[model samples]
Target: MTRDTPHLWTEQKLDARYENLFGRAAGYLPENRAALDAWLDDFSRDVHERRARNAIVRHPSVADLARLIERDRIVRMYVSRMINEAHQRDCKNTVNDIPDLLDHLDCIVTSTPKYQGPTAFPMSALFTYLMMTTDGYAVFRDQGFNKALLGILREWCAHLDSKDSQEVLNQKNGWLSPAALADKKLNLQDFQINLQDPYGGFPSFNAFFHRELRKDKDVRPIDDPDDPRIIVSANDGKVVRIRRDIKRSDEFWAKGQRYSLYDMLDGSDLTDLFVGGDVFQSFLSGGDYHRWHAPVSGVVRSARVVEALMFTELEHTSGRDAGTESQVYGASVNTRGLVFIECPPPIGMVCVMPLGMTEISSVTLTVQPGDQVTKGQEMGYFSYGGSSMCLLFQKGAIEKFFPKDNTGDMEEGDPIKVNARIAQAVGDEA
Candidate 1:
């Protein structure tokens, strides 16, 4: 049926996209298409009835279907999940949707079909899962999102202690050293020495205050499980934010832009590791795809053959401070042949990397020198998601990260919102 068009979305693509997503989501449903259809028909009628019955409930309406369906309990369960996932890709403001979604949860839950074996995802549980995925801080901006997110944290996490980080924060029981501090969004000052941080010998009151640590982490100095954030926002100091292409070596930082992409990573195409990036978070592992897949699929072209590499690592190795959006994509290396994730047509390669609490701490990749890879295969695992992957383009390849209407370039250290085009990959061959 008719769908709402986002400022960035095209009217023409909505039908096709929704249909395509429905098809893919349908895979998670039963093989019996008839049963699925029947469940949907009843689900829509139920939602309509609820609107008539009560106005305070929040649920998803199964209306606007291209075709009718008469689904079973199992079918209804899957449909609820599918609807929730579709909205996560692009949220909609249906005042009635939430209550309706929550209402059906009880009706469809039961120990029916199992995913692998014993662990079953029932309707109510799946509804909760979908709710968690979509109920992120919405309708907010930079600070608002931060405040709202932090509130959610307070609701779900424990209270933090100090935020004034002068030295390297101690690793807590299960929290990063620096996190919430970055969220304070405060400016830094000069002449203030944090006698704690041990960076390069040079010290000039690090312009970007708290650049070393963030306040978003759990500030469990001793062992406070109730700490909401690793680092507290109210008590933390400032951090320094360096742009992409940051280099410890003077030569590289001064003249990195001069050299072409090939020279940056120091390798060639023919290799086994095709893709590599900072392991901010993962869906397969821990919502990794949610952080990377959108930008990857948006502008990547079909002409170039591509492989996928997911790097898993601990948060401390990347030196990522809290409050700063974690990077999930970075400079991917290719030591062997020029085999890499090709640049999406016209939109070079869009990288979605969220480097966590560690940017540097001596980490190693569990991958060999050369290995072939598929688009979504794993290459190696790092301690944290702190590495980088480069979007490779052969000698005569085109690089694209931005769409014409939108300019979402992957310029070193920029946050990528969903549906934002990062780059484009288009060359002579493209």
Candidate 2:
């Protein structure tokens, strides 16, 4: 799709789509409602409730939201309203209330995401309905609240990493199902799967989510691997934006969601090297390949995962595609993995950043400092969540971008294949 074309369905369409999906589970059962009521009562009367209450009030944004809304409601209240709205819309199998929401979230943590088009962002969808509002948006921006949220998500990630999460690998309504493979356009032949083993020998949902790509030259061959000048895409995704003369710090929260180098790199010591450099950002859909690859042959200099907020999105752009448009903003604020590679001269240093969006916050890195990496070599992968990637180049490092495009222009939603030539180094003529 072109940049001008909206990537999300309208509210009516979104509602209809989710409604149909939920219909299969039957509307929230009576037992679920009873459990929800009981939990709510216990949650309200618990002596430890103040701890949960403080998780909101201590955060600046949540405090601001409470004042503006003229009430100091707890997190449970906010989540309950959010889930109730979805329940009221007749979206089946949804949480009956806040307690039910926790249980639903637990289920998601242990199971892999089902194949559903763009509407696969169920958590984001529920948050979108609530967070698009003035109060909800402010509350989500609170660091304390997000910290608590991240703790919960980390636990979920642990569960996803365990063997129990592999139960969803069945051919029926699972990731390997015919319907899912067709929907994702994933060919098992392109990957390294154990044909003899059930569930393709994957140990967990996370394993299946970041399945290894075959090393055959033709499968995802490096584009001119010997040519250091030919920079390739680090991951399989759609180009979101390409910006030059990036600032050290900018109005990242503004409408454009401009790149803030210092913030994006997590204040790394090497941030200054790319002050006026260029950044190539892209968005990875739930169904897209999740592995990271070297954009240029180089030696890994530094690599680390930076912890940050999990669910915050640009308030103005919430609800549509569940903050897919907020990628640039996410790069600055979300949890991400950063890998700095020092390539041959002229190409200099390149930084590959994988930013986690919403529920997809696990950034697993396979390489470490001092390791030599070749172009298209696997560096890491993101486990089961919406994700985006950014490649940062040093000032004047790149002579041109979108190597095949004569105009050297890229829109927000342009598809970019992994290992495909994306840019050219400044000194390389070929």
Candidate 3:
């Protein structure tokens, strides 16, 4: 296929596509229909029960807490086993594609001769059912489960860091192959990438993804350094959503989506500071630059890595391709690296969050707490795969934003580059 362009399918097209995929499962495997329907019904009830409990004024009984703990323990074990099995298969069977393994769970369609088309992931009704189910929620919330997943990711990172991984990445069929790299439209001359052996360089795919640009090149902070009034885009991605005067906990703008400061901040003490803040959500495409840059010059107050579920796309219930559009309220659920930056004067504390998606959720932090960072400086990056980043500002810090051609629509926004001016600060207090 030619280099992929952004294909914005109309709502009718999306509906038709989903209906066809849903019909394939329903028609070819009629036996699974009843079970899928029954699971959806159960999930709806679980959601109702969850909301009912949230409305209850009294604290949960000790028995209820104990039962929840037991359930969590069981789910944690199951999730751990699932990760191990998947990792083993990928490493031993050379089955790099994960969606291909979903067939074993009887949750997705399988092919007789190793399928090669783009993986239609997170489209399975069973996958959606699993995410909404009580067990799935428990597995998601349990730190142990997340930690286990992280452990595997770190090990994989170690391997990728080795010379062997670099060799693989430089091979014809590797991630950096001409065919695969074509989609990115990468121009080596435009970037500060090392040309030591132009034809076969790039220490690894990780290095290529996080490659820095030349000092005299395209990306840089606006000329006015003394002005605290300017805020720049932290990464190269399309704006998905922007919200102002956010509540402590309320439904996200996306339909049927809900999130709270506690969940977004991983229940840190910093959560309260952002109860009534402004949030800007944007996501990277598969071929977009992967490194994260500092959005403002500030003191790093605190930086924490939060453990969360991977491949948990919130907008899946809306019958959209996972990771293709805004993930609605997924920032709260995906494993993320959080940084609280205390912007000088006019712009106060701001939060920069980099969330992981799919199997490439490993975050490598380049800076730590107490460090002073300048705008456009690297903060961190995802090892592989497209991910999302969020910017949370204190209420009123950003007086007004000129999101280029942004109309506040979820589908598309003006293409942004790191260090490019995106918003301006106000003189008034939030």
Candidate 3 local Cα displacement, residue 46, angstroms: 39
Ranking 1 against 2 by TM-score, winner: 2
Name the regions of candidate 2 deviating beyond 4 angstroms: 1-97, 115-122, 318-325, 403-412
Local accuracy of candidate 2 as per-residue lDDT tens digits, 1-430? 1221223435465443333221111111112323333433443333134444543123333233334334435654555555555544443344455544444344344434444322344455445444433445555766656765666566667767888878777677776766765664465667777646667789987888788887563777778877778999998877767789999999888765478998999889999999999988876765568898999888999999998876765644423232334666788998999999998789899999998877765888999999999998889998767778899999999989973321211222577889998898888455
Q: How does candidate 2 fare on TM-score?
A: 0.75
lDDT values, one for every candidate: 0.25, 0.66, 0.56
TM-score against truth, every candidate? 0.23, 0.75, 0.65
lDDT per residue, candidate 1, 88-186, as tens digits? 445332213433544443222211222121112123122222322222211111232223222322221111111222122232211112331232222
Query: To one decimal, what is the Cα RMSD in angstroms of model 1 from the true structure?
Result: 22.2
Off by over 4 Å in 3: 1-147, 171-189, 195-200, 219-226, 251-259, 319-326, 404-411, 428-430
Candidate 2: C-alpha RMSD after superposition: 9.3
Ranking of candidates on lDDT, top first: 2, 3, 1
Candidate 1's TM-score: 0.23
